[model samples]
Target: MKTLTALFTAAALALGANAAFAKDVQPDEVVKLVNAKTIKSLDELKAAAVAKHPGSTVTDSELEDEYGRYIYKVELRDTQNVEWDVALDAKTGEVLKDERDN
Candidate 1:
């Protein structure tokens, strides 16, 4: 029936969206790239982020390739309990964005 067809369509769309959002680079590949000096190591980037936000602890991190450019994103919580989102250039360990989460 039309109702069943609509349900299947909705399910397909949901799965497609999930797949798009699940794009991520493998950790070992990332390490290999860093070793080859193609990108800065995650540890160096994390250290830079920690230095930028003194007394903050990193909670999560991710590496992404967008438009052929590698970017590193990190989430942190400061001593005052404020959440911060930081983006860094994976190639040079530069800070691209540092924003406080609402």
Candidate 2:
């Protein structure tokens, strides 16, 4: 009985540690994802963009401040290897800006 209790305690502690490491995204920020059809995480957002524009692959992804709003910057290259940038609301997954790379 004591061994079982100890094992459970250790497992709970490990789970708590993992939770602490997880990103704590706010509810209002995550609510913006409701508009997107198939996007939940930053990676998913990039994949959706590539899927929309075939032959394109993500080249760079970063968090940037634009016009007083925090956004995720995603750069992709098409089959021709032409590059473009897509900016998304970091919290809500909404597209804020889309422009071809010059």
User: For each predicted model, how many residue pairs clash, with residues at least 3 apart or on different chains?
Assistant: 0, 0
Highest lDDT against the true fold, candidate: 1
Measured with C-alpha atoms, the lDDT of residue 28 in candidate 2 is 54
- Model 1, span 1-102: residue lDDT tens: 999999999999998876576456788989899989999888998998888899999999999876567888899999999999998888998899999988
**Residue pairs with backbone atoms closer than 3 Å in model 2 (clashes):** none
Give the poorly placed runs of model 2, Cα more than 4 Å off: 1-40, 65-68
How does candidate 2 score on lDDT? 0.69
Q: Write the per-residue lDDT of candidate 2 for residues 1-102, one digit (tens) a residue.
A: 999999999999998886555344354554564356323576766766676568898998765444445566789899987888887776567777778999
Q: List ranges where model 1 is wrong by over 4 Å.
A: 1-22
Clashing pairs in 1: none
User: What C-alpha lDDT values do all the predictions have?
Assistant: 0.89, 0.69
Query: Candidate 1, after superposition: displacement of residue 15 in Å?
Result: 17
